[model samples]
Each structure stands twice: as structure tokens, then as C-alpha cells.
Target: MKNIKFLIAGILFGIILSKTQVVSWYRIYEMFKFQSFHMYGVIGSAVLIGIVIIQLFKKGIIKDYLGNQINVKDKKKGFIRTLVGGSIFGLGWALSGACPGPMYVLIGQGALSVIIVLFGAMIGAFIYGVLSKKLPN
Candidate 1:
């Protein structure tokens, strides 16, 4: 029953993402190039809402997300790791013209070419998983 509910929710979410025109490569490209603010506008609004919700929950006005208290904790990492990881992620986003979240949407919309991007992303994740322990703090 839980899996069924999750599957239905996922399907609905994918449909909405597609209907919003967020799954298109052209739209993603425009966002990365700053030629369009459509996607960013949505992202900005979501961030604002998230901040408000988090603040309210922190104040004990609202219990949410399974009643677990939320706290902001910065990851400890060296400057080099941060810089290198960010650069790589940015390069991939620029080259693919799609951020990670939208990549799944693109795939759902029949963009088989995204498989290559997915492969690269998986490899990058694997590398990070392997090297995270050895990376300087």
C-alpha cells in the first residue's frame, strides 16, 4: 500500500513537471544562460516558502516531516573539495543544459540522450562516495 501511494504520487509529480514546461532542454538552457527567468522564478518562490516553513517549525509553531526537529548544519569540508565539486557540478549543468532535478523530467519526456548525463552523474557520485572519507576537512 505504501509503495502504491508513493508510485501514484511520483507519477502525478512527473506529470505536473512536464505540464509546466520545466522538462524541456531549451527552457533549461535559457535558465543557465540567464536568458529566461521562468525556472528561477519558480525556484526562488519555492526557496522562500521553504525558509518560512522551516522557521515556523523551528519555533515550535508547527511540527512537521515526521515531527523531527529541523536544524541547519553545515558540512565540514576543505576549500579545495568545495571548489572542485561545485565547479564540476556547474560544468555538468552548463554542458547538459539541465539541472539534476529536471534531468529526470527530461528523461520522462522521452529524451534518451539524458542517459549519458545520468551516466556521468552516477560516476561522479561514485567518485565522491569513494573519496569523501579521504578528502580533507
Candidate 2:
């Protein structure tokens, strides 16, 4: 299948996340408690890498699978929205011990408990979708 590559890429990413311990609840706890630099360092590296990739996209150095230049949209400034949304996300991550991305990895690693977190995330996303129109733009 043409989509097999994407599945492979996802598996690779999951392996990296697992091996780096980025998906570890202990690492997450350390990050929240400011008790260790491991997670912070990983996050900082990711931010730096994201900045570079975004710049590449903006400069037309990156292209989609269809060979079209990737479009980068300017984000609208919203401090209150960001604060509230980030706080909620952080609370969920702290309590669930896994970010949404790693929820699948947790499951793959035999953490059936993460099904509860995945369910909660899905429900939250659905609620947000329903309320998005009513919320601030």
C-alpha cells in the first residue's frame, strides 16, 4: 500500500519516543516538578528543530508529497486562549501521564490503562469541536 510508508514512519517515531523515554511518566513527572532536565532538554531540542523546519517550509525548501510548497500560516495572537488551552493540556498530561501522541505508544507498549486516557482525549476533542464555535475566536 502507498500508505505503508506513513505507517513505518509512525512506528519509527514511536520507537524513538519510547527509547528516549519521552513517553515515560517518570520523565513527565520530573518535567512538571522541575526536578530533572531530561524532558526539558528533549523539549528544547524539539522546539529548536521545529523552528528550523518551519523556516525551511517558509523558504520553500520543503514540499508536500504532491511536490507543492508547504504553506505556513501566520498564527493569530491570543494570550488568554493559549494560556487556558495550555493549562488544560498540561493538566491532562500530568494526570494521565501521557500526551496524546504517546497514548498510542503506551498502548503499543502494553499499557491498556492508556485506553482510558485515549478515551478521555477523544471525548475532550469532541467536546472542544462542539464548543469551538461558542468559544472565543
Clashing pairs in 1: none
Error of 1 at 105 (Å): 1.9
* Regions more than 4 Å wrong, model 1: 60-83
Which numbered prediction scores highest in lDDT against the true structure?
2
lDDT of 2 by residue, 12-129 (tens): 9999999999999999999999999999999899999999999998999988777999889999899999999999999999999999889999999999999999999999999999
Ten consecutive residues with minimal summed lDDT in candidate 2?
A: 62-71
Reference-based TM-score, model 1: 0.77
lDDT (C-alpha) at residue 37 in model 1: 94
TM-score of each: 0.77, 0.97
